[model samples]
Target: MSPFVIAITLSAAVLHAVWNAIVKTAVDRTTTLGLVAFGHVLPATVMVLLLPLPNAESFFYILLSTVVHFGYFFMLGKAYQHGDLSVVYPIARGIVPALVSLWALILLGEVLPAQAWIGIAVIALGIQLSSWKVLRSGVGKAALGFAVGTGFCISIYSVVDGIGVRLSGNTLSYWAWGAFLHIFIAGFIGLRKRATLAALPLRVWALGIAGGLVSMTAYGLVLYAKNFAPLGAVSALRETSVIFAALIGLVFLREGNWKRRLGAAVLMAMGVALIGTSA
Candidate 1:
């Protein structure tokens, strides 16, 4: 990856971690997620009106990505319900890059060099290391299962959106449409939890929507980076967000065991350097 692409991806990682921290702090994960979806749709709706439409060929990929994203969100909510941010977040983010790389190799025929593979492994190991205490103590089976499911959904959508944006010929247009499609999720969740949705204070709504915007921008950066780099490598670099999330949890949420998490972050940073150099 070029330095420019690496910078963008790393920035996205920070933003991604920030938004997830917001969601993790919310009282109702599903309702907060719905608001986040609304946050995505609100801006996306305006952009869609102003931007050119994506090509017809890209629609199928866009739809596929949207469907996969729904699954991802649902699984994420379930994971959060059963585990702490530090525990669920690492496992969920940790598994995605490897899965994405495997999918890219098998389906997209994109084979990465040895150094890139080593970087991915190191990053994955660091992610696991950050969660070692939680894993050793046993994050409830339910959380582990849902988080693993979330990882699979993330990989599916990453590959789908990578191809989708390239086919659209206009990165912003594809991003806008993808964001707008989250409205379906927002609507569904809103309808299902009308009482909860309606009862949320304005402050909570603001936080949720802000979280949505951050999440949208984060993914948008990744989609743009995908245009210039291999999907697997880009995905692995993006998983550095796990390290960011750990730091956010420690500093902001006042979570414990900072020494181990910091060490994990250092290892992850080294892996990120390796991947950037290899690129």
Candidate 2:
């Protein structure tokens, strides 16, 4: 990958971690997520209004992604309610790349290096280790499981959107429509829970909006990176969010389950090193 694309991937990693931290720390994960979803629409809707719709062929795929992303947000909200960032974030974020690598091999004709496969496993195993305490702690384990499953759904949409946007040959247009639809769908669900959304404090709104914009920017940069790099590499690089998320948890939330956390960090570092070498 070029320095430029690598830069985008790393930048997206930061934004992704930051936004997730906001969600994890929310008073009500579901309501905060709803606001985030609702917030995302303003930008997405504006883009949809300004840009041409994706061609008919890719439109269905975009719709599919939108549906899956809803599940992602819902589950993520539930997960945050139950678990601390240290545990839930690793489970939700780390597991995706390995799945995505397998998906890329089957769907996109991308072959990852042997070393990267080991890296992927190390990353996953590290996360698995990190989660042991949470599993024993009895806080939102079910919610964490749901969030992890939802993250798998998120992985599917990301790969689909990545491929669909590329096939459309207009990256921004597809992203705008797909992203806008995602936000619109989530916002509608939240509006259905109007009381919860209305009660969100200004502080939450401020943080949520900031997080949303960061997330949107990250998505744009990652999609742009996908244009040039293998999906697997991009996927692995994006998982760097796990490292950042761990730090966020330790510093802000004080989720200092250190034995498990140190192991998780080691696994993430191994993954990053392996990926860097392969590049």
- Among the numbered candidates, top lDDT falls to 1
lDDT tens digits by residue: candidate 2, 1-279: 888888889889889989899888877767667666666667887888888776777887788888888878877777777777777777777777777878888998888888988888788777768776656776566866875886698689778877877776677788787777756666666777788768777898777777777777888888888888877778778878878888888888888676678568668767855764575
The regions of model 1 sitting more than 4 angstroms off are 133-139
**Model 1 lDDT at residue 71:** 98
Candidate 2, position 237, lDDT: 85
| Reference-based lDDT, residue 160, model 1 | 95
Worst 10 residues of 2 by lDDT: 270-279
* CA-lDDT, candidates in order: 0.87, 0.77
Per-residue alpha-carbon lDDT of model 1 for 1-279, expressed as tens digits?
A: 688998999899999999999999999999999999999999999999999999989999999999999999999999989877766777787777778878888988988778876877887787678767557887577888898898899999999999899899999999999999999999999999999978889999999999999999999999999999988878878878878888888888887777877677767766755665675
Q: Which residue window of length 10 is worst by lDDT in model 1?
A: 270-279
